[model samples]
Target: MSTATPPVSGKLFGLFCLASYLLSLSYGSTFLLSLLISSRGGNEHDAGSVISAAMLSTFAAVIVSGHLSDLLGAARSVALFGVLLVAASLGFALTPGFGHLLLLFGLLLGLGWGVFYTLGPIIVASLVTPTQRAKYFALLSGSMMTGIGSGPLLGRAASAFGYPVTAAFYLAALASLIGVLLFWRLDRQLKQAAVQTTAVSRISWRSAGQVLSSKAVFPIIMVGLGGCVFGGLSSFQTSYAAARSLDYSLFFLGFMSAAISGRMLIAGFVVKRDPFRASCLLSGLMLASIVMFGFVVDSGFTYLLAAVMLGVGYGLTYSVINGLAANEAPNGTTAQSLLLFSLSYFIGVFGFPLLAGKIIVEQGMGTLLLTVLAVASLNWLITVGRLIWRRLSTTRALQRA
Candidate 1:
């Protein structure tokens, strides 16, 4: 196989971005899964458990997807997972009760997400040169946020039309089907461009494990913590809003809007500078956003503002840290680094909700928020520590010279 880097094509990249948007939209609609659980006579805890269980499958998929991509090729792997997502979404509509829903969504939908999320960036990395990677990554992130951000609106629109929440599942299914076809088309285009060679590689477990080096630890931890905050906030927003008589959609709208804009407008500038420092600043924003959501958000405006702060904070932070993860990888380990990054992130994203759900049920949203606040603060402190450490190391090296 030719190992030469493929020339980048704008049209191919555009197709990839469009597919990402649709795939994410399919996944994002599940942001309202908690409401479905409620309608099924389940509580917050059940919602958390089911969602977390589904995420467990996502975790498994992340691990398997690298090898799958290596074996079947990236585009084919993505298309395969996309098919699974479609089946899972349709299953959500046809399944009778909580147990069936759990089995289908948890295993199939979660697995699809794991593969899609993990491979999307790897494919992008292959398509772009190092100089163009950051900008393209930001654009890809923006496209995904647009789709994810639209998910809540899709659910709301369904309800407005008197369709049950399950209707959103069918919509997700449709989106996934379209996304799959796009990936298929992209695969054909890639073949014609001769960039198809860039997509296939042999990835091993031992190679994937190399991402655990010291350089990657900080970003991994920070993204994981961000996941915790996101998992808790997004997973239970329905109950949180209901308790306050506010609209949950405000949070998603504000979050996606700010996150998408931040990546488009600010991420390019920030990613070019000191990532650790930028991450520290963004962490502070995350901290404030959590506090605002927990304590200060009484009205819809406050809620939206809090979400926007979070969008600016976590959203941009994610991109910066992701860049760090890819950049800091030991040479030849970019794929492994990204896979590990996604795995760590899913752990926090899916793991926390299971716990937060119980906390919301037993102790209320206040306690959950406090817990998330602490996690965010720790993430900030760690980034600051990493920054300080880097500076000190540089100073010592100069002194030695």
Candidate 2:
């Protein structure tokens, strides 16, 4: 009997292409979205509101996306969802004014992203073997980060290319269009028609309800809070750098490179060791990194060091949480659980950036960075509390035994 598993050459490649291209476009659209709002004569407050609204709407829809995905299969749902997002994104680009921007950001992006974000992971999980999951996930995450890190730069280049906001949308559309095609190709291979009926039969209300009520809920909620705090650091970083006479772009790029490398390296190691302990330690490291970011008085090397620390910390901590969330998923609640965890993160994403903006506007960017550090510290505290509880429980159980 052969113990070796076959490599997912054709199908997985197709899926990776889809994920990479789509996320790249999406990230570009993110930068363009911010710029578009600014170009339309909207102030910082208005921009924050628009972005926050889009994210909140996306978060709400993620719940539905997850449930529906398991009911349907992961691949078909993702394909259909991607197409809808393409249309919505294109429409947003074509629309004339801020009202149209509101319509797209508030509605289309939300619905589209909710579905896309929820299903993307499900599809990846479906395609790979359990043994390959760690490597696959790390690579997948790195690709998304690449897209994100390059997004604004691409958008700027696109704007320089002459389409202004329209160019960004076009780039985004092309990315999604490519994603749609890649998935469509893979759909031909991986999806089994006979299993569709069996898949639908597996869906259960009781299972979902049980999931809704669980001891794990509180811990999951903290993941969301941590996400917001992490995002807040990015929201305030550039502005903070300006105060310290830093080269913002260099510091930013250093963080991005470190983050990508960290995710790629740390993910495999964590899977080999104990995931639980690894994640908690990484989360603590992220908190420490934020503190480093907070106190950097020098712009030259110190700022770069701070960004790299933040990158490494987030790379390990945030990526591990994603894997843990996958492990925690219930039988039928694969998509739902995926979205639920993401839902919290996105909510934090939407709110925290705005919160940072408010602080920056009212007090200063330094205040906003402080806010991120404070939130990160809280995340560490919560993680430590959980660790302490676990140790105590283990001691008691051993004593009783």
Instruction: Pull out the clashing pairs in model 2.
Output: none
Candidate 1 structure, TM-score to reference: 0.94
User: Candidate 2, 126: how far from true, in Å?
Assistant: 2.2
Off by over 4 Å in 1: 1-7, 191-205
Give the poorly placed runs of model 2, Cα more than 4 Å off. Answer: 1-7, 32-36, 67-72, 87-100, 129-132, 156-166, 192-209, 212-219, 235-248, 330-332
lDDT of 1 by residue, 1-401 (tens): 22223376667777888888888877687678789878888788887886787677977798788878778767788988888888877776777667745765667877888898888888877766665566667888899889888877888889999998888888888987999999877875654554323333445667666777548867887889999999889989889899999988888989999999999898878788877788899999999999998789989899999999999999899998888888887777777787888888888887888999999889988999999999999999998899889899999999999
What is the Cα-based lDDT of residue 71 in candidate 2?
63
Give the best candidate by TM-score: 1
lDDT of 2 by residue, 1-401 (tens): 12134255644654665466574566435544545655766544554565566676775567566556556555566667777667766775776656635645546666666676656666566656545555566667676676666655555566567857567676777777777666666664655421122133122456546555753454466667776775565544445555677755555576778878887766667666665577678777777777777774465777778778777777666666666666665655554555566677778866676776677678877777677777777777776777788899999999999
Ten residues in a row with the worst lDDT in model 2? 193-202
